[model samples]
Target: MNSNKDIWVFGDYRNYFQNRVTLQILARAVDLFSTTGSSVCAVVFGRDVDEYVAEYIAHGAQKVYVMDDPALNTYSIETYSWLMSHLVKLYKPETLLVGATRFGQEIAPRVAKKLKTGLTADCIDLELDEKGRLVQIAPSFGGNLIAKIITPVQRPQMATIRPGTFQELPHDYDAKGEVICLPVPEDLPKDAIRLITSERRPSEKQKIEDADIVICGGRGMGSKGKFKKLFELAELMNAEVGATRPVVYSEWASHDSLVGQAGKNIKPKILLSFGISGAIQHTSALMGADFIIAVNKNPNATMMKMADLAIVADANQMCLGIIKAIKEKIRT
Candidate 1:
């Protein structure tokens, strides 16, 4: 509880398999150890969380601080905030990292407020300054510009990183780490909000982040009618459909399918862009695409310039042609 210079990551494993943000942050924290010279640690609060502790070690955590108790069986924002803030005070860690998931968004700010520290939210990248201070990079002015922030005055610099921003380290079963169990304070106060019941409602739609191939459409597709054809193409090619903000706002696509700074970041192996102008907000999220094929009438469009293969043509016509080609290939 007294390691003042260690980098700490909060373990969020509720959607352990589906949501890998916690592990991703842990990997990034581990990378920082070389520059910051701080031990990479994870703090987990849950019941029967030995598996998660071990997983953290395999994923690059040098040590883990666990608070295992029946009281932590369910997540309570107030209770979690109080406990996390208390832990920060006790440990005095130099930096704390949390995933920018909904759960993290709710708890991180409260803990920062309690400890009188600054927190940067939804950071796209993290690095150390010349003085070894944490530099948090995120979008500003509605994704028009990027900002690098540092909590120079705070003891525990805090930040919530966007999901899919970084890749997790591969599991190493032979990795060694120390696990120190911490006792939950007996004087913990009752939470103001209580969870009466919980239910699981999983989405059947493919998450764009997990997609190997992505078919992305933009407002240049003209109307909702033309935009809907991307789904057919996606199905034919076994790809996920992504949309630019303008297309989503025009009701041509659902918000869930949006790819932008405000939406989900995707790192698809292959990305096919249709009629997109490549606004930075949309382009920034797909920077990790391994191969890009862009179809647009304007050869000078940003998307076309960024593509590995740019085709100058009507997006709708190209989409229909690709679909036809796929069907013919399947029949043969």
Candidate 2:
């Protein structure tokens, strides 16, 4: 086994262009390298995936290991877990980071079990401890409190990080890195199940995490009828709608639009918060918003304090006024 420690990021290229979680995790691994003095590497398995390897290098990977074979063309949890466990045994990486996508959530735990190492899921942040162990920060007790956890005796500590938690580094065309091509192992396991065919449906709207402008509503919107106005405002402003947990539970919004520690993390350029009291669970997720405009009846609400511009007024009245103003502007 190699004596030097390495930080490995799983390269998920199924939606390379649209899903940027892999690049974001690679950027975070590079940042950790400064602290651990470990080599930053990416591992990928897919056919015709050379472009993704180059992209990873451009984004700060010091080295890339690729197994580009036709047999590995599509994603198979069985094949992936087997291959990943094999690689870890050979290279002995100190830490492994995977994106908390559906694919990753399935494969990471399997690999961790095969290696008998601890695995943390849906981590919001990661930092190294004084002993150089990876400290995983995740929500606990239904998102009320934050928990920091560590694996005391596990090799290649593993964690699945939420998407949008970290930003990716800028692409550098001039950057160079080593690419190690590996042949498929002769004993690669056959998948228990075979894929026949797959179909992808087009998305009808933008995901809340990727929105440039977000209009968020809380319980103070009074009633579901009043909350519906946020959708009107969103359409007029060309923005996406987000909701607090209480609003979602009240059936005013879908779970997809829920934003908080237990839900999606958004970093829109501009965020408009209405009637939210600024619970820690909700505010922590939107900390990355470039600018915030908050409206609430209580001037001392936590949300109001955190906003760049705070308005003390009835949320429904303010929402109606904004909608009317926008309509008049459109007429002129």
Candidate 3:
């Protein structure tokens, strides 16, 4: 296997549904290494995976490796990681990308350990250096600075990228690729944990991470009623509402709306911050946005320093003003 010619992506699927996040990261990887002669390949593991190989090819995977088995119908940390390690050994790919999802968090470290390679987690960007090695860029020191990491001695350089950080390429249905089906190991672990049940709960009213525009309120909103006005503004803009960790911990908003290092990492096109002090944890998560507009009474807040535009005003008043402005614009 040529070290500089093949890149592998862990094609993540859930309950027979293909994860678009994998395609998004693959697109970015293609962009990062296009000048080099490297081709992208996706390794998928699931039951009835043949039906999904075309989807990965359409997203720029030159080849799709399928490891299908009934035991993989639901994710088992030990089973999936073991399978991935086997595939990596077989392919000897130079780079491996995985989505930074719950499953990814569980599986990537285990695979890295098995392969004895470095794994960079939650990477926002990727690039290639002069020597044709990958440069994984992720937040460091609580998002105060972006760190670029390289795997000099690792055989398969591995990184887990955050979803929404990469743009998915336009699909080409006419794209063609080879699908190799690998047999599951016959000597399966008899005591392997089997999935007992699966259920889907009603999703949250808003997924702030997926929202294109987010209006976040902080403790400075003063009261619950004022926070309600922030929701009104979000409604008028057809945006999702978010909150700083302090606001959520204070019961000003639900934990679902918390946006920070410990909360959901968002990469919205526009992030509007209200009444929240930009703590390192919160700022680290939102720094990936295209545009940041922060509103706070304090001029010296950390968030204000990093914002593209800053408004020095009370949180409630700003929310009300924005709601009125949006309503007026709609009427016109």
Candidate 4:
């Protein structure tokens, strides 16, 4: 278990390329492990998964183990857990990283339990301790403190990283690596649950993380009535509405609409934050935004400092004014 050590980044694949989270993990693992004399390998599963091996290689993985199986195409807890557990037993990787999606969260714990290992989920930062062990850093106590968790004795230190927590490596078409095709193990169990139908909602109403434009509200919005103005402005702009932790805890918005270190990372084309003070816990995830416009009454707010445009004004009146002006323009 100790001699053949390597970093294994689970390449969570969607309909298109490997999910962005996997690449982010790969980029990070490559940066840390390559110098420590550990190779980076991507473990990908799906029907025809080999097609993605080269793409992963370009993103800095030295090797890829592709599990191409019809049964593994869609996410099945039973199938994924068994295969990964078997692989870990055979190879005994030093580190196993999974993207913290609903699928990763489900399968990671199962696989870790099977291997008698420890797992740290939703980590915001990562570091290598002096012992060369992985350090999993995440928010704690309502983002007041940063907690570092490590599995000191575990052979394969496992963790699930939040999406948008890190940047992706630039693709290098000329880069090359080894690709291994894995066959479906004979004893893998069949999935009891099945997916029947699916639908894609319009971006305006889609998940906040996937939205192109995001309008976020904070505690300074004052009350529920005032917070509702964010939605009105969002409707006019065809954007998604997001909230800071305080706003969500106040029941002004749903948990899915929350953004930041503990919630979700958002990198929209346009990010308009209203009344947000912009703590590091909240601002860390907004790294992907192309244009940031932060509105807060306090000129010294962190959000204002990070924003391309900072407005020292009342958020409610500004939102109402924008909505009214947009409506008037539409009439013309």
Candidate 5:
């Protein structure tokens, strides 16, 4: 094993804090690279971001590399990619794990091309194989087959990792780690996609990924009018609403609310599905749910067979019944 072969983590920021996805990626990296005596180095860049260094260290990075400068204040693909490429050439890391976020997805490929290395995107699983090579597992061929990708010849095997694919490491308040501030590359072009103005979108109170109880619909939901029932159900239980790919494609739900191989992987405490036929693409994402309760008209549906509790009935009628019963109970 190469001693210089370190695991570099891209600590992507959101709302002035380290994104949960970045912490999730570093946690897995720390576990895998620790066996090889490889340093888990987290790279964070922003203006006045000294606050995040300790948090990253608490999440399992042995070394937190900070590049705090006004020039790195706002995120730009051009500047970030050039700087990341510089770090790779200078430090010669063995593996680089990036959060497969909107920002990360756009930047990872650019940096990979700059460094002339292979990059695997949106990996659901990552492990070091018997040969000490990085193995990236992800879905391929329209979510029909699982593909294992490896970069044997690339110096640093790079991967863009999805959140909720792995559990985050617990914070060790008593743990002590190093924080080394790295100087920003001076050669970065100033004219690289200059930002004129920016506006922030209002945040949602709830999202499927963060919900403890999620109620998702599928093609069997029948129509958009019926699809609104999921919202009423969610309100009754204070649960978040998710949907299968078909439901999302049909515009019954937004893409962010989609739970499947092609969408978000949610690990709710209670995952309740209605009228879902249990396609493999949809079922795979529910592996992390604590409890799965399925209701479908068809008793032989795949989701029903795999559910912890399967109710054979009319999904719409059942949903209305539950809502009615709850309201009546409240009145009493």
Candidate 6:
């Protein structure tokens, strides 16, 4: 494996229109592989993808491969997989990365099978070994251990990384990249999955998955009423609310708010955990936070041991006191 080859990122777009997580991953990939002399390229497919070429360049993509066609407006498993397979075959990149979103989960395995290559899913970290092979690290055996995966025989080492697992560099408007327009084949099988009209439901006020500041509660929250105070404090700070797995399973909060190995991984600027005994699984997922504050009745709890600020107190009263202090600061 030569270190001079390029690294490709699948710039997955949602319905050819909205949010894209690949740009963030691409930024991190650029930084990770920059010293190896491997430039980062992004592959985007859509109807009018020309409009997004500059966006990819701003995110540190050295080249943008655009596959524009009307048939690509909606996601078709067959079309997407075929297109990616073609790109992988054509470019022959040393490494390929895709976000482990729903769409990626659907397409990546299929592409890997088509290419007859190995893939590591839900990878948390990536690096290159002495042989210039990709070293993909992901949680394995229910988060009990970290596994380092490598594809020595595969032409392009493929991996699907979780969103929020990597930090993106600031967008540089003056960053430059080449845009290559690819042709989408006109003769393709009709999509088996039909897209009916889509509908949006009223979602929660704040989503823990995307929050910059998160306050989480756990089993030691005592009762549902006490757990609710976490949300009050979260609201006062205009932050998002989260919980450990036990809190969600016990019905103190919904499953979407759960954060841990079995739940969503969050990289907040500040993470505050109340009454939580941090299991290794939960702590591994949140150790990337810039700052962590843990409060528990037991001073020896795992969370208290690892937290920057550990407070031994009644969890409920401490949360209320913090909320009051925040409110007073806002008023003054």
lDDT of each: 0.88, 0.89, 0.81, 0.84, 0.82, 0.81
lDDT per residue (tens digit) for residues 1-332 in model 3? 24555889998865222246888887887787777778788999988777567777877788888888887777778888988887788778898899998888889999999999999999999988789888999999999989999998877889999978887887776888888888887755554666788543212556888888998888889987678777667766768888888788877677888888888889889999998888888888886789999999999998888889999998798888877776445323
User: Which one wins by TM-score: 1 or 4?
Assistant: 1
Model 6, 1-332: lDDT tens per residue? 33238888988766222234687689778878888888899998878776567667877899888888888887678888988887788678888899999989989999999888999999998888898788999999999999999998876899999987876666676788988887886655578888886432213665676778998888888998788888777766767888888888888888888788888888889999999999987888796788999999999999999999999998899998997787445323
The collision pairs in model 3 are none
Selected candidate, larger TM-score, 3 vs 6: 3
lDDT of 4 by residue, 253-331 (tens): 8787889898999989999999999988899889999999988999899999989999999988888888878755542
| 1 or 6, greater by TM-score | 1
Clashes within 3 Å, all models in order: 0, 0, 0, 0, 0, 0
The 10-residue segment with the lowest total lDDT in model 1: 198-207
Model 2, 170-256: lDDT tens per residue? 887788999999999999988898999853322337888999999999999999889988887887787898999999999888888
* Candidate 5 ranges beyond 4 A from true positions: 1-3, 16-18, 204-332
Q: Which candidate, 3 or 5, would have the higher TM-score against the true structure? A: 5
Which pairs of residues clash in candidate 6, taking residues 3 or more apart in a chain or in different chains?
none
| Sequence-dependent TM-score of model 4 | 0.60
Q: How do all models score by TM-score?
A: 0.61, 0.61, 0.59, 0.60, 0.61, 0.58
Error of 6 at 139 (Å): 0.4
Q: Is 1 or 3 the stronger prediction by TM-score? A: 1
Q: lDDT by residue for model 5 over 148-206, one digit each (tens)?
A: 99997867788998867776787667767788888877776675466987544223678
Candidate 1 lDDT tens digits, 1-332: 23377999999887665577888999888787766568999999989999889888988999999999999999888888899998888888999899999999999999889988899999999988889889999998999989999988876899999999988998887999999999999889987787898643223367889999999999888888888878877866768999999988997888888998999899999999999999899999998999999999999999999999999999999998998787555423
